[model samples]
Target: MRACGLVLCVLLLGGCSTTTDPSYYWQSVSGHLRMVGAARPVDDWVADGRTSEALRAKLRQAQQLRRFAVTELGLPDNNSYTRYADLQRRAAVWNVVAAPDDELKLKQWCFLALGCVGYRGYFDEAQARAFAEQVRHAEPDVEVGVYPVPAYSTLGWTNWMGGDPLLNTFLGYPEGELARLLFHELAHQVVYVRDDTVFNESFATAVERLGGARWQATASEAARAEYARFDERRQQFRALARATRERLQTAYALATRAERLAAKQRAMADFRQRYDALKAQWNGFPGYDPWASQANNALFAAQAAYDELVPGFEALFEREGRDFTRFYDAVRALARLPKDERRAALGSR
Candidate 1:
């Protein structure tokens, strides 16, 4: 939807021709319900229906999450999810999404709670799919799974309470790290520097580690185990991200110099060849094929972005002595600083 007549519609969600009413969110739920009723349906996927059992299970899960959100997260009881869909639809979804037509309604929900009202969510699958397709067409190396969308991307304006159900798995993590995953994404929602992919992602990476424990405390033992599994997987990811970052440094030096273009190409080709071999060397570990085939301009542009400043996350975590709350305040404080100022702060005592 258009925010204050601005073209803020995330084009991938099958956005309509005109901008949406951003201020509409300022209204109450009754107001949002009326607003959505007048809008046009977004995509063909909107008509696709879930099975009865699926709906029931989703509702149950959502109820669980609603309780979690309130009991653990301390959100308001009367969340927007209540007005949108019944327990069934909300439970099935891990995040709440706005349809092209329901922009104002979603925004209202966002504006009202500043976080999710319930545990479960609603989303426009078509839009998420469209964004996925666009991201894919733009950069094939990045693989996204719609398990839960990145909260930072969707909930920023709403104050990072709600989250999308989409996730990235370019390099899959090990089992039992669900808490880490949640923490990582939540961290992104907490603070993000616009268009600065590396800084934003790295900050989230650090938070995921620091915040995992607190988030897990709300869930059951099984959920906590999942976080451990996820952690193991992350250990491997750290290696890959670091390697990618170093490799990108080399690649970038070559990319900038015209005279070395051909040499760089040859070097990259060799690097890819070695990378493939390197990937194969750890055959039982993980597969790199599916993503490699989708290489494009974005892939080249963000080739080694995965671990460019991993040490920053590591350093922050270490500096806080693994104190989660302290880490949170520290980062949020730093986020207030300008780019260079933040860097200087990081470097100074």
Candidate 2:
């Protein structure tokens, strides 16, 4: 049955060819199949003698998190995260994002089901970097960035093929972080607005933040303490990034092209200096060094999709009395609205 489902999924993915490049679709299909093929039932791994005790413990914890997502957070209950795969890779996929040299708006890629999104993803890091190079060569005025993605969601499209299995890429996350990542991905299955990357990502992030806090309340003191340190650094880094993005947006809006370009360079330099000072305060934490060093329009634009409108969604959740189901229903209503209207509604709230 699972094999038949996999075949059907391939056909469906292949048949829905909206992109001009057939190779892209082929890579997408093959990459997904390879990952799915590598996965086995979590129970099997837990019982296997070859499975180390450490991995076995993480797998069991993942199941518990999966259950909490469904029963407590009102996330989808499915085969996702019920199985495990070891990709033996640093990242599950690499994403390429590009933007105009002076603009914070990212280039868009349209697809059959995903509609238009800000970034394109490749299962192979080489392919992703190659594509970014192509974009840079073709458009001299475009800024391109390639980044590693730990995980992505299919929005429950391939549930019949055992859903989206947990991968080694993120299974070892701290307990709160693991819960946050799981809740965030499952939220995609709840409400996805095609073409509105900001809305979709922000909504998922809101769910993760809310669910993470709830999970942490019941977590062991050790787990909670670990997540606290991790989250504190993350929050500080995000703040710095957010401030820089705002400065760049102002620079991008300058009247003349030359003025915009000059302002942008100044803003970027100030951003780096500020980040350096922030890093010094962190006692030598370097987690955000790569991102700060490579900051540009494309990177800032990609980051916006995840950060923009998060506060509004968080507020909406509060307005819904923090009931997950009610909040989701409200978000679904917003998703059904025209993009402009949806943004207006979220903003007004």
* Poorest lDDT segment (10 consecutive residues) of candidate 1: 1-10
| Tens-place lDDT digits, model 1, residues 231-322 | 55445544554454345445445533553445445544654665566556556444344334443223333323333455676687678876
lDDT (tens digit, per residue) of candidate 2 on 1-349? 0000011123344345355787787777888888999999999999999999999999999999999999999999988888899999977888888999989889987766567778888888999999999999999999998887777887888888888889998898888888888988889889987778888888888888999989988899999999898888888878887888888889888899999999988888988888888788888888787777778899888887777888888999899999999999999999999999988887832
* Candidate 1, position 228, lDDT: 61
What's model 1's TM-score?
Answer: 0.50
CA lDDT for candidate 2: 0.83
Report model 2's TM-score to 2 decimal places: 0.95
lDDT of 1: 0.39
- Angstrom error of the Cα, residue 186, model 1: value is 1.9
Q: What TM-scores do the predictions have? A: 0.50, 0.95
Clash counts for all predictions: 28, 0
Specify the highest-lDDT model's number. Answer: 2
RMSD of candidate 2 to the truth, in angstroms, is 4.3
- lDDT for each of the candidates? 0.39, 0.83
